[model samples]
Target: MHQPNKIAFFLFFILLIPFGVQAQGHEVDSLKNELKGHSTMDTIRAGLLIELANKLTYSDPNEAIPLMEEAISISKKTDWTLGEALSHRQMGNLHYVLGDNIKALDEYQKALALSHKITDRQLQSSLLSNIGNIHADLKEYDLALENYHSYLTTSQEMGNRADEIKALSNIAIIYNDTERFEKGVSYLEKALSLSKIEENDLFIAAITNNLALAYKKLDENEKALSLYLEAAELAEQMNNKYIEASALNSIGKIYLLFNDYDLAETNANKALALSKEIDAVEWQSDSWEVLSEVYEHNRKLPEALDAFKKHVQLRDSVVNEEKKSELTRKEMQFKMERQQAVAQEEIKRQQLVKNGYLIGAILLLIFSIMGYLLYKRRRDALEKRKLAEFNAKVAETELKALRSQMNPHFIFNSLNSISDFISKNDIEQADDYLVKFSKLTRSILENSEKKWITLEEDIELMKLYMQIEGLRFDNKLKYHVSMDNSLEPDNVLVPPLILQPFIENSIWHGIAPKKGGGNIDIRIAKDGTMLKYIVEDDGVGRSVQNREEKKTKDSYGIKITSSRIDIINHLKNTKGSIELMDKAEGFRVEIKLPLELQF
Candidate 1:
């Protein structure tokens, strides 16, 4: 959210200002000496300090905090409102990174307050935008919207196209999160237009991602995929791993939803690998969730369970941190209030004693004892609460890990049946089926070792698996496969062999029992930043008896996959999902993901 480029430029200019200002006598020499003492305070001292702080933002926030505080003090002493406001804004950013949102809000408020007293509307707008970010994080949607609108108005008034575009994108994200996909799309489109006007590749990629997300929410997968692929390319060109990982995760989720298990697994694994390389914890969690679902659906129960457990552990850690911070803040507030009341009571007692009293030391001792007991009680309660929270987090993490290991093993009996067909059927046809079956076996072997794959490759494998099934069923099944042009083949990926088990289900459980032949259709597209796919089958669908039996089988594939998808959708900052719908005509499976495509 903090633009390095802008911060760098601001710091550069702040550093330049001191050189242009002449100091007259002793005061000038003192200022020069003070500047010399701190390398950051040299001629362009303000800018240098800001730059130093910016560079240390992520790597050494603790080190940057004191430097920023010093800079703020210097700015105020020097009557440099711009520098002061920048320092405050930087502090807000640091706190945000440190996961101290309340502190971040406080600093942003100070920055905004200072901005109001200054002539720089641009700075004011930027500060307001940061405030909006805090509000959004706090889940105060209305307040966040108000601040974002304020930022937009100020940026427009200042004719700052870049800031305006960013503001629009931020607003769109909020709208999308609130389920106002149409409104979100409108804002994103506006941002895209402005990005084009600026010819900013980064902004374009960012807007494309936002647009994709909006479209995905609206169920427009094709358009979403196109935008995601385009965005991925731009991000790659920029060497932005964060965006690249994001794209991969989105594409994987789409494949997962469509029962394209192989692609989902592949893409998600790629995303996880990239995220780990970049140390992006949030993205890593997302990839794990998708992988869990893919494995679960593919009947690789153990792998699915592992992924699910990891997802819950990561998610709970994040949540627990937030809760801890909130509790700390509440405790601090209570202590401050209690101290204030004690101070007031002490003052009143002093006044009473001074007015000529006989209540004396005994009364004072009694009051002191009561106050101490009250303080001790409050302290004990706070300590107990902290302990309880710690215990809860530990329990949650353990439970999640246990749940992750709950995937049931699928027996190799199904493969044995396929083998049996080889010995009894026509030799040549049986040989070809055996080859196809071997390839499927190999795919499973390879995928069992990994969590993700490419959508294109996954589809090819699924086709092979389906072909073998067709031979076994005596060519009684018909199938169709289609993908949106927007989904770039190389960039899009998915979980490995995820589709075969589901298609197998349709063959063995849905169509095989029916006297009539059946058709299966598989389609993939971009839903927004989300990839979406649909798998439909004109089979028996979910009959009452089959549904009951399916529930009791304890088969890891479908149930595990579905649960994993749920975890991914909940844990990811971006959207990803899979859904099953039974229609009069057939069974329809829908998958939606954030539009992610990485080269």
Candidate 2:
């Protein structure tokens, strides 16, 4: 009984799709005469052909085929894409009504491609809906939902209330067919609201009836009965006998469920009369099903058997139509596969001819490439050797220029310290500072010729320089140097005197201005591919130093050191940097350089 109801429901949707033509108000003979009056190969003739064909699509679909084909031909001749697309879509509708879904889908697809080319949103939406209908009929629910959603979105964008209601209702039917009653109810409710807003009596009656069916499936029989009654009343007011019969049959089913035999019999008989008037076999079958159950409940065995027989007969007719549709689908599929096989053979033959020429060209190209690569290899090697030699010489010259600037800057700062000690009348301290400075100067000069020195060697040179500064402060400075256990200072190389300037700044500026003096800490650690160095001093921080002294010896030393580090970075192609930050009580400096290993 429910199967017939579903079949009857889909049969009604055919009238909703506006395919080939809006020819219902005109007669077939009149359209044929109008088409005959225009015999020229133009869009007017094409349109007339489509209209006449659509007029006969239901009555004589076989005869309408040639008319649609001629319309398509004329549309092509006139370069009218819209006409061609509509004709193809109408052809699809004819095939669909004849139960050949495969051919119908093919025609719809063709029209869809043409519609997209012409940017026709209305035609595109209709084609999507048609494609979805075919997928729904074939029980491809996922594909059906996908296409239906696209149609709904397009309709919403266009603000077409009628199409929007149609999309919503179509989607609801799929959900209901798939047994997702809750989702079906949601879509149908939205569609019902839209239909009422549009004041379309037919749509309202159809949507109300579907909504009731969803309620019945959910076991809400009382609500279903009320809605079914409302749908029947709406359909009757609109003079829509098919929807009226559907709603009445559903009402009868509900009454039978309640065991109200008299009312069930009355509603079922009324539904049967309406279905017969409309020639709706499925609805008649549903009515008979309800009556058969009602008769059996009343213990009327003869009447029950007769009603059961009628129900089975009508059900078989519906089933036989479904079988015919399936057979037609299979026949069309076989024909399509056979045509594709022939096309594939032609493509393969063409490919073989193209491959023969391609092979000869590839062989010749390979030989030419081999000769070019051999010559290019020799020329590239020669250029690479010359370029390397020139770059090495340039790096050496730049390194010496940077070193020359640093030596003079360092000597100037050292001489200033010596002058300071002597001015204070501290003879022994001055002499001691001069001796230590001389030794530090000797070490720097020795390492200056080399581009890089071991970390251990550089740290030793720093210790001597700091000791010299300690004498100037009368042993006021305290310092400590630490190295990570994972690093071997002797194996790592850094530029000479890279850390001296920052250390000198920490002592004179960061530590000397403080009341009790301060301590300087130097730390070296392995940081991935780079060597990390941190130099921090605990003293009267930079803020205090800025107030006391405007110009400091360390500033000049730091400028020279930064320039030297930049040169080292350019030569080595590494990112070496100097960063200085102020601590609450002092100043801190961090330096990173490429971690080059000697061994």
Candidate 3:
């Protein structure tokens, strides 16, 4: 869990103030004077305004949106494709940060169109990269990968190392998310090497943090811890509060994994403090979630519940802020358009005057026509923006709810089993089971906080679950998991408990009723960009005579597992599937998914 440093919004604001001052001092004054003389100052001032607005994004997007609209208007008036493209690019970023993905996509496409028109290779590459990032956030992995590849190719052709590194890093992140750890680590390492060569400490720290994450997934805790410390140190040296907080959180998570509850709590608390200090709502929420797990593991139920509540509250608050910012941007666009419409209406009224008044009327009419057109366009734009904002909010909220609900079900089930064990009189067995259950619970609780994990850890969790079940159904079933040493430990990740349920289904439904017993086989193999898994069981196969009955019972575990796979597919936007096959002897389940591992 390496935490990358984040640039402060205020820094962007500060960067733009100088540009804004320049615009005010010379550019804006020149444009104003030219406008009075009915002469176009071309698109120079418009372009400058767009840049200034970009700087204002995190600090004051309400002010920025109007500025962007003004830029668009001027660019359109001058027919300056480059200026228009840049303006749209800035707009896309603004919408993205505000969580208006649809609007962001629209703006990015517009930017891309304009960039293509002007044949600006650099701008085109940047726009492509931005579009890829948007798709990645939307969980459209294939599209994201395509765009990232294009960006990488273009950046490399232009010999732009910085852009190349960024493209590589983005691709690595996608791989990491999809459980293709090996490919993910390779790309990240390349990016890190390039960052080091370029002497870019910020990017170096970022890549290092990501590398730590990859290491953590592989269960290389020592390596992960070392890399995290390095990243944290670098972030501190850079005074990057966001990255520092993230590093602290990563350390906390590692501590949690090692079962050092006190250390975990301390690190998480430190991260929360830093998040608050920096006003980073997302990171603050993450810290709270981590703290909740720590408290829960320590049997501090009340504190755990309180922390969980706080985590949810903070998460919702961040989402609300994104929604409000998007709405504000729409409102600003509306106001700007309204003003233009009023100006245009006044101009049209003057056009009907006669004779000697015709000249003045015509002049007034021309000004009014331009103003009215601008106004109408702006109003229409605002309406579209508002609709986009609303849709974005809805999607974000839905996704959040989906993620929140996923793990609680697992927790409840595990807890119920623990309670049942407690009710039985086997104190020693209960105590041992409690320890294993607690570890499993803690792993689930902490790992869910992250978007991805290492293959090694995932496998370990599966083994733990199987061991627990093995104890429960002693002598009823036997299982074996075989792994190839050639498959690097550092380069694989799978969905947590992804294989366990299938195994459970086999044991409970397929094998338990049989007199002799059954055997479960689990194996992993590498297949291009995927990790192929085969789980087969030698038990009562589906009966040809009672097909419907067999299907119904098997479908429960299959449906639940399939549904989860579907969600993962949707989130990653990849082609991953699970198939249940009736073999000659028993039942076989084959799973194929993208290999996302960090080697």
Report, for every candidate in turn, its global Cα lDDT versus the true structure: 0.68, 0.77, 0.72
Runs with alpha carbons beyond 4 Å of true place in candidate 3: 1-41, 285-599
- Model 2, range 93-127, lDDT digits (tens) per residue? 88877767778889999999999999999999988
The best candidate in terms of lDDT: 2
| Residue range with the least summed lDDT across 10 consecutive positions in model 2 | 1-10
What digit string (tens of lDDT, one per residue) describes model 3 on residues 383-468? 76666555444444333423433344544454455455556745456556656766775676566435567878888877777666
Candidate 3's clash total is: 13
What are the per-model numbers of colliding residue pairs?
41, 0, 13
- Ten-residue region with minimum lDDT total, candidate 1: 5-14
* Error of model 2, residue 264, in angstroms: 0.4
Full ranking by lDDT: 2, 3, 1
Candidate structures ordered by TM-score, highest first: 2, 3, 1
Q: What digit string (tens of lDDT, one per residue) describes model 1 on residues 1-599?
A: 25222211211122222322343234444644655776654326875566667656665678779878888877877888878889889988888778776677778888878888886787888788777877676566798889889989988988888778877887888898899999989998998898898898777776787687678789887787778788778878977676778878887776766778887788888888888998877778889989877875675644654676576556546645655554555444444445556676677557655543455557767567567766776686577666555444433333332232221122133244444554465445644654575466556555543445678777887787678667767889989999898777677766555455467667766678777779889998877677777888988877766677864552545665554455445445666666778777567777775554556
